[model samples]
Target: MRIVGISVLCLFCAFSAIVFFTYYRRNSATFSYDIVLPTIFGNSTEFNTSEIKKKRRAFVVNVFASWCTVCMQEHQTWKEISKRTPIDLYGIDYIDIEDNTLAWLQEPDNPYIAIAADYSGKAAKAFGLREYLKLLFSTKKVNWCSI
Candidate 1:
């Protein structure tokens, strides 16, 4: 009975440690903007990384996929946001076809100022794309005009 209790206690401690470590590691990882994301459409255009970062206009780096229904749904909100504020909205199309991204943008309802195709997924990873989903989940209103 003593041996069983000790083993159970050890197991519990080990499990708790693992959970704590994972939670700490994920939360502790700071988000940075050192990444120079490549552009799919702006390749022929004159836009550069510094130009994007240094622009006085507020920028929203939206990482999305053409297949993602959420991205399509957010288009209207983005449009409204753009109109109400002096924002330079950029998009990183996470794993999408260039033609499709271009076609979708050409649709009368597009809102992005610049759209980049993240073919390798590196740019999305750099931008902490997953964390942005949490923003959408929250109830707080994100007002760019006030920012």
Candidate 2:
């Protein structure tokens, strides 16, 4: 009985430690702007990571899909933020159709100064983005915007 009790306690502690580590790892993950992806622009332009890094201006990279309700809800807030802050806003359309994304932006205001298409989801994967809506901020230190 004593041996069984000890084994159960050890298992519980191990499980708890795993949960804690996973939570910490997920929340503490950081994203960098060193990635370069093609833009949605007609000019065949791309998101110039080197230029952005050189400028060192604080900017926001919003990863969203046209079909995501949470993203749509946050769109207004992004527009408001753009008006108030000097930060440049960019959008990454994650695993979405370009036509749908364009049509969605047409009805509402586009807060993004530039838009990129992540049709293959590689950009999203590279950034370690697991959520439908993720806002990455490029500053002196790279961080994820909670809002």
Candidate 3:
């Protein structure tokens, strides 16, 4: 009985530690603008956040995919919003075929001032993007703007 109790306690502690660390790592993960991916359209082959900041006081980095149904649904909204906001909006196409991304963007007004294709998946990893539609708003402070 004593052995069983000790084993159970050890298991509980181990499980607790894993849960804590997972939570901590996910929450503490930071997004960086150092990502460089192939440009699908607009601007250039490189994504320079600083250059965008120079054009606008702030900017929005949206992570999207060509196959995402929700992303397609929101594309029009983005086009409308971009037409109104002074802030420059950029796009990172999450793992998808480059041609598909371009086609999808061409269907709409293409809200993004610049869009990049994340062929290597490094851009998504660098952005700490967990979802297909996560938006990072850079103003006085960087904030995760999920819509």
Full-model lDDT for every candidate: 0.63, 0.80, 0.77
Using Cα atoms with residue i matched to residue i, what is each candidate's TM-score against the true structure?
A: 0.63, 0.72, 0.73
- lDDT, candidate 3, at 57: 61
Superposition TM-score, candidate 2 onto the true structure? 0.72
Clash pairs for candidate 3:
none
Report the lDDT tens digits of candidate 2 across residue range 4-112. Answer: 9999999999999999999878755754446788888434488765666677789887899999999989989998998888998888899999998988888555688
Ten contiguous residues minimizing lDDT sum, candidate 2: 138-147
> What is the Cα-based lDDT of residue 48 in candidate 2?
63
RMSD (Cα, Å) of model 1:
6.0
Please write out the lDDT profile of model 3 over residues 1-147, one tens digit for every residue: 999999999999999999999997876676565556667788587876656655536778888888999988888888888999887788988889988887777764778888887877777777676667788777745433444
Instruction: List residue ranges in candidate 1 displaced over 4 A.
Output: 1-31, 42-50, 131-147
Candidate 2 residue pairs that clash: none
Order of quality (lDDT) = 2, 3, 1
User: Which stretches of model 2 miss by more than 4 angstroms?
Assistant: 1-33, 42-44, 107-109, 141-147
Q: Is candidate 1 or candidate 2 better by TM-score?
A: 2
Residue 61 CA displacement from its true place in model 1, Å:
0.8
Q: Which scores higher on lDDT, 2 or 3?
A: 2
